[model samples]
Target chain A: MIMQTIDLEADGLRALNATLHAQKDDTNQTSWEVVNAKGSHAIAVGLDAPIEVTVRGSTGYYCGGMNKQATINVQGSAGPGVGENMMSGTIVVEGDASQYAGATGHGGLLVVKGNASSRCGISMKGIDIVVHGNIGHMSAFMAQSGNLVVCGDAGDALGDSLYEARIFVRGEVKSLGADCIEKEMRPEHLEILRDLLERAGADAKPEEFRRYGSARQLYNFDVDNAGAY
Target chain B: MCGIVGLFLKDKSLEPKLGEMLTEMLVTMTDRGPDSAGIAVYGADAAGQGKLTVQSDDAERDFASLAEDLGTAIDAKVSLYQKDTHAVLVAPADKLDQMRQALRELRGNVRVMSAGDTIEIYKEVGLPKDVAARFEISKMGGSHGIGHTRMATESAVTTMGAHPFSTGPDQCLVHNGSLSNHNSLRRKLRREGIRIETENDTEVGAAYLTWKMQHGSTLGQALESSLEDLDGFFTFVVGTKDGFGVVRDPIACKPAVMAETDQYVAFGTEYRALANLPGIETARVWEPEPATVYFWNH
Candidate 1:
């Protein structure tokens, strides 16, 4: 199928996103290129079909938010809430992303080639996030189910109040949050890490990473762990 | 949410573009804060001269003959330059306090924004674009500056409630989050005799830094102490006569990005605010660490 190209500078955010929404359920119109984005907000939100979107420049808040089967690519840096609450499909950011990237996402594969700011993947459920560079504090906070792969460092209070989500980091961890701790990397975990790295197109080997998860100490209310509350 | 942008030029060649670049960065954050806006520019200083940036709801009544009135009251030369709702009063360096006191006695509605040899603050209750255009910010030149767009989570939405609050001479601060202990801290700082004009929580934060620096702490030390003293989720960007600093709370709930090159050091609430800056494509960009003070001095 022939791909459609939308210039954000000429068409504006309303027209460009309206066109994508109109073609959401049409499988034939599968490919799109968005040029001159220039930090516009809320691009390609609530897409429900398996389409391909490429954004040429940096975007503002909530870019590619609440997606369900479309693949979105941002060639430059992104503002806050990139791929927020995404249910399924893929979002790739070739440059750095601001705070709360992939926040509260349910299901999808989000790839960040550069650093992600504070609170990356907070409260994520079932989504798989792969970041090639460093991630900031409070990442994966209260996450229920998902996989977060970081090729570089993780900042203060990583995986705070985590629940069921798996975290893998290749570099130094500044600090860990309550009920979250380092666990031994088994063979199966290594295989999963390798798969995630390959899928995210990262160069680092899976063996260099360490695993972190909930310690299960704070799973239930107890007098012994009352101080943790 | 609030937004902050700071730029410190290390190379003299970029001085001419300081206001233009800062204005663009400030406008990009209009979504983060749409209620009010402000900017603080550190221009070249004249020897033995200081400037007082003052705002009045009735500029016509208060600023019509303010220079002459203040000049007579303080027994010195005072030149007033009006820009819409604000005005800059240049006076003898030694007579700044006297001039401030006289202005207070003369005009009850006048509020001093900043008084320094190099700093001139212009802020109002409007969008960033409108505020910048009102003050002709894009045409001004300086070595460094800081700008803020306020969402007004705390206090009333008045002209004095806007950000880039300057409580000390040549000192100003912009904040992105709320300060939980501002009421108690405001009283404490007031006891210490730091001049605070607004009920805005950000003003208390700025006054705290000014008090600390007055008590012999450096800008970096003052910011470091803020992590322990101030209670709340906050990201602070501060400007002094010759320095710029940034700090985030331990929780780091607010977003902040910094970029640096040999020519300059720039800060923004998001990377998009810094994307259009010169040498940004190759600049070293990263998120400031939690509870750590990052500062640069010329």
Candidate 2:
């Protein structure tokens, strides 16, 4: 097992991020440190091999953009566009993230322990992004294909212009977007959510949650249902 | 405290670029600072130096005569001069250095500020829409401009109380939070003969930086000085005619974040306000730094 530890200082963080080529399984873990890392875009990028990277504190923008088969974990918060345009990987944030997390992801799992800001999974292609806390407005706008699960409340205009992506909410929804509907809950969703929670390390009980999914009616174009959508 | 809208145009025509979006963004943020509001539209037939700001205390000397004297001192035509405010503007971004020098030549309580290309704000207490409606804002068109809405605090919310408060000839400030050391810094500035206006703590900060800019200190230096000198929980969006500036408190109490892309860069009190931009892409979003001074050329 090959392991790497970085303190997230300016010099060390820059030096480490400057030379991260996924040759084999690489694991980098960061500890608690007061690092005034401001606006260093694309903190982690372009990794195809299966590697695990962890940042213990809060991070700036695009923490794991353009990722491929890498697992990134943050014990603290992350900025906007975390796990953006990801091909395949797992990015878990233990705390709240700014707007647009897991945006345009092709395939991967993004588990956020806390609430997410507006447009949580915009234009998502194929991904499973789970949230334990409430989400802000326009959570799944223009989603092509994915699954966005929220255990808490969702803001106005939830799942606007959704396509093929399924959304499950166990809490209140302020408003529904175009082509989105609240469907019936079932037993199989409970098992799926429980497994996702276990992977994300959520402490909520499975029984307290409810399920939601795509209505499938909006998947195909219709002339009469124009106003409904 | 005010509303600001900036547009970066790839083409020369500034309009149709930010005409509608700027109106929406400014109107949405109107509730934040509502003492006064004004828009500096930069587009076609636009002069980089929109107006001349004259500051003076010549006993009984008239503001119009002061403008005439400034015109004589600089040997230029004073197109519009009203009660301590004067403007001798040119078009098409041609006279950059001469305009800066012409404004600087006339010395009185009168100072010509931002001669190259900028908007001079003279605000009063009112709603943003009414105040902006009073002034015709479509003449001075350029690629980008900033607007402000203010609420009075320490001093009265007078014409001077409004913001994009010009702390210097080129620099202006519009703050969202309060300053802790108001009286302490106010006394210091007063003893040094710097006139203090408005009881708002934001003005103290504005004056502190104004004094520094007048005395040849850079805006960055003034901000660094306030980082240690003035204590408070503050978030401000400051800038010059050609640049952008941002800063926040050390404790991180108030929230201020930026969402940027190839086309536009926007900062809002919250993320919900700036969610739908002109051409926002999924992968080109990020938050600006908190509790630090951030700036850009845009």
Local accuracy of candidate 1 as per-residue lDDT tens digits, A85-160 = 9999999999998889999999989999999988999999989999999998889999888899999999888998
Write model 2 residue lDDT over B29-73, tens digit each, in one string.
577677665443434334433454443334145354544554565
| CA shift of B225, model 1, Å | 0.9
Using alpha carbons, what is the TM-score of model 1?
0.94
Top-lDDT structure, candidate number: 1
Q: Residue A63 in candidate 2 has what lDDT?
A: 81
Q: How big is the positional error of residue A185 in model 1, measured in Å on the Cα after superposition?
A: 2.7
- Each candidate's interface RMSD (Å, one decimal) is 2.2, 9.9
Best by TM-score: 1
**Over the stretch B1-88, how does candidate 1's per-residue lDDT look in tens digits?**
9889999999999899899999999999898888899999999989999999999989999999899999999999999889999899
Worst 10 residues of 1 chain A by lDDT: A18-27
What lDDT does the true structure give each of the candidates? 0.91, 0.63
